[model samples]
Target chain A: MSRTANGRGGHGRTGGTARRGTGAPEAGETAAELGEFGVIDRLTGERFQPEQTLLGPGDDAAVVAAPDGRVVATVDTLVQGVHFRLDWSAPEQVGRKAVAANLADIGAMGAVPTALLLSLACPGDTSTEVLDGLAAGVWDAAADAGIGVVGGDTVSADTLVVSITALGDLEGRAAVTRSGARPGDVVAVCGQLGWSAAGMAVLRRGFRSPVAMVAAHRTPRPPWRAGPVAARAGATSMIDTSDGLLADLGHVAAASRVHVDLSSRLVPVADKLRDVASALGGDALGWALTGGEDHALVATFPSEDVVPADWVVCGEVRAGTGVTVDADRWGGSGDPGYLHWR
Target chain B: MSRTANGRGGHGRTGGTARRGTGAPEAGETAAELGEFGVIDRLTGERFQPEQTLLGPGDDAAVVAAPDGRVVATVDTLVQGVHFRLDWSAPEQVGRKAVAANLADIGAMGAVPTALLLSLACPGDTSTEVLDGLAAGVWDAAADAGIGVVGGDTVSADTLVVSITALGDLEGRAAVTRSGARPGDVVAVCGQLGWSAAGMAVLRRGFRSPVAMVAAHRTPRPPWRAGPVAARAGATSMIDTSDGLLADLGHVAAASRVHVDLSSRLVPVADKLRDVASALGGDALGWALTGGEDHALVATFPSEDVVPADWVVCGEVRAGTGVTVDADRWGGSGDPGYLHWR
Candidate 1:
């Protein structure tokens, strides 16, 4: 979800500015022109908060009642050039992406996201319209996830950086950790895989058509409620597919002390990206295997039969180490899973 | 707290490689060279994590038990050049300052600091040693406040940006909000005021020493415990002095619908900075009145007598609006209170 701002173009990305139901920012009014208070006022308008918020913005610190007496927290930071290119994205997409990623992390924890904290740092020269667009996208994403934007901070930087922290309610359920996977666990994934990466490639190669892929790349819709559903159905190990399916599954494998073996042809995600892959002369299977930022939930279950419709089995856990596709080890570094520094 | 990172020396401050604690990053061993996982691993070593954490790093989301059934949250961001000049301060000092400011906000809300989430973005070319220093400072600061570093995120940005989100436990006490202030309340503050501002001026002028002031500018040590004390003593409203004493108090006044009349002569913060101000030929009173980032907690108590020794009355709340210094309206804008986007 990090780096997904800029609702550029009229693509029907789930996080598009058009879907935000708001007026566009005036082209001439930059963030510096409006000043900090003005920008904060417009961005944090009344729409983003929910009734469950004990105390919303405009205070030293916000109070959120944690009825379960336990809180689950995760934070993600998206830098302008590194995470997303402003030219490739619209402000709304960036906001949606940030919120969605954090929510995805919470979902991976087997919890329901309840609140979000946004820490935005953009150059003074940024347009207020863009900021508003970003805020609108953030609000839309929060509503979609059944949560609220609670508290945050805004600062001036030479570049734009949005860091989102999401807090969730476990609803008295035991948190599903990465360490819980066992030898007999069945591997599964719910939500997208290679679409985002494929879309990025489409955008990079200057081909605009395959609109669905482009939109998914612009705004990923993480399966927000799947975390709670899987938790109730007995998920053992779980993680959001922010670092590609194989890479994140590798994390689960290492932490759970079990090996995961995936059947390349068995994953349904490759089918969804086949058209986009064809246009780019790319391997959708490879993209589905290692492409990151889909924010998809990758988990291991004691049994696959109980997994809901949102999730599908892709592999199984065995008493070995590392991840393999059809009993062959996954490729080495630079194999598309999306390296941040690179 | 937003703009108080660097202990700025007259030296060129583009993130010096000199100020790290120990272990020089190998030549050309940049963050990019180490790769995301390598850098994350080196930055999140075991020693920095505190034991109060139920689930530490490495999970999708970390779990923290809130025994009081409520959680208070706040976030703040500090940018390079704007917040701190790397040449003037050590990496550790930047980390400490970030954590300290957020803790101050929680304290102002009458809560005990519990966990911190660090969202860091620095250029990939940044040295590993610098990251370690920043992490060390964060750990040290968390330990000083009796809290733990629970989770965080790291990304590559053109500039260094550290955004911190802090969560707190209220311990069954009602949160002290700005709207609760009442007429006839005693207005008081705990901790230093002008020191940080004065220190900044000294650094900006390329004049070092009065070592105390320089240190204060580089790293502010907030009166963290005094916040809970004020709340326990029936304080009606409270805010951390991040926006300078007058500007922050102005926020309290506007929110509480009360006029705050301050006795300029009573604020003793001027005494400590008199020497630094004298050396710079600046006004110590002005700095005390409007200098920011000392992270002092200002609260409105039901009675002057109940206010703790750590705090002293500098004003009184009356049935009116706005703030007055010595029975006169405070100075207009262009004051020292860190205005953003101006």
Candidate 2:
């Protein structure tokens, strides 16, 4: 391993060649040249300590409050090639995606997010400004979710890897888990579906779309408040639309031992995607049903009660063990959903 | 990437011929064959929970208490090659080292650890038994530190990477920061020094020593209580010996704008290391002075009081900048303590 001092006072520049398609300026220096301490100082700028943060960067540990007494926690990791491609996504987008993924996990559990801790690993040639952009994205996402970036660790690696841990507060409410979906419960969704998948397709096919879909694919804006709202509305079960609608619903089915059926007509697929899919001889409905990364809220409610206006009725739970679509079992070749480790 | 699946079930196998000399059993299966859920189930087996844990694993998130209102959080990552070599340590030792590194960060803040969230990335061919051993080591270390492994994420990767986030409770005590050390404070240490570096030297040279030093390097047993004890006893500033004593103390100096002078005779150097250093044509005092990974507690106390029994008065704080030894600038060409992100 090569040893080089890095930090704020080091000889490293801030920005450099922005990978390939990221559109970032290529004038910054790599992390190795900046050194560790200098990079940390740069990352922990004035904005690190927001109003909600009791203590921010610079210390060994950061102090935040779980005023409700209960703290909710979740962790997720995004490997360079497996979870993202540096050539395809900007550093800011990668940072946002990393935070969004963990925040979605927290939202699925019916918690109000409070803080995030990040551990980032990158190659020695990685620019300090790219890292700063990543930090900017993280901060922006946390601010969007009303949380703070409390602390993080940085290291050198062959490939870029980002790991995030999100902490939340339940505020005396019980967590909504996937295991609580009862038979006869109504299934509902609170955000857009298939938009991210459609965006991903467009990106892969080297085509363009109404900027909205592409933006959705690059950085999902999860409805953070819907989590506590569902909990308050007595949601029987809950999950985020991370691994496609059907795949995530399957988790609730397997955990709760209840079958769920979804109507294709209820899902909101982009109109342009329908035309694009028809042109490509593919099914837009499949993308809406099996596409992941939308991060919409999928939940189960009692049949007798009406779901809030924000949530659309997708289907209902039945006495069974698997997920179905419009009374037919989902027999697609892809097994259930994305298994994180697999 | 060779995709051979380990068939040791969820716990992963430990024995296999392909096992590189890491002390792990050679004949073992990979983690992929066991699947993601299976591995999680195997690792968290019937562990008891405290009342503070409202909800544990198996959900999108876990709920724990932040009774004191504020939660202290820190994160650290240990990469396989950079932090530890499999040829020199066992999986259990790696697990312990990972936990210790993060816990030491929490200890530096004078907080009592509450919970840990881990994200692990490993090759698919790794045995389930290896994972089990690693979990066992994590549990053992957490138990020793009076903390809980509340939640974690697992993923497949080309190399083994463990990122841990430790949450701690201040317990109504004010956070002891590095900036708190005063010019007139007495510098003291509460645990072993140079042991881990000596063990590393032994491991690198292919030499053996008392099991204690080797174990010290493998699984450092940090003095967890010393943090809170020193805090309660009116310690003005503190930090763990993750880097060498002088280097780490230099941090306090930089933070507090005070110079620290050390007495070489007062610093603790293991006797066996002294002999080993002599044989290696090196100075044992230098190791004791600059060696890291001891996880020992070093703090500043008011010069008006006698140091506590558990601690030894090794130095004194003076009005100046940077750290010195024997009233002179102590400089050695060896490792300049631990560098973050290295």
The DockQ leader among the candidates is 1
Off by over 4 Å in 1: A1-28, A331-334, B1-28, B331-334
Candidate 2 per-residue lDDT, tens place, B148-254, comes to 66777777777778788888888899887777888889999988888888788878878767567788898887786788888888888887877778878877888
lDDT of 1 by residue, B1-342 (tens): 010010011101112223233555544468888776665555543434444467766788778878888888888888888887789989899999888888888998899988887777888888876788788888788878877667777777899888888899899999887778899998999999878888888888887877888888899999978989889999998887887888788888887888998998887655558877777788888888888888888999989989988798988999998889998976633245665667
CAPRI quality band, candidate 1 = acceptable
Query: TM-score for every candidate vs. truth?
Result: 0.92, 0.89
Best by TM-score: 1
Q: Report how far residue B221 has shifted in candidate 1, in Å.
A: 0.6
lDDT of model 1, residue B293: 86
Minimal lDDT window, size 10, model 2 chain A: A1-10
| Total clashes in model 2, counting residue pairs 3 or more apart in sequence or in different chains | 31
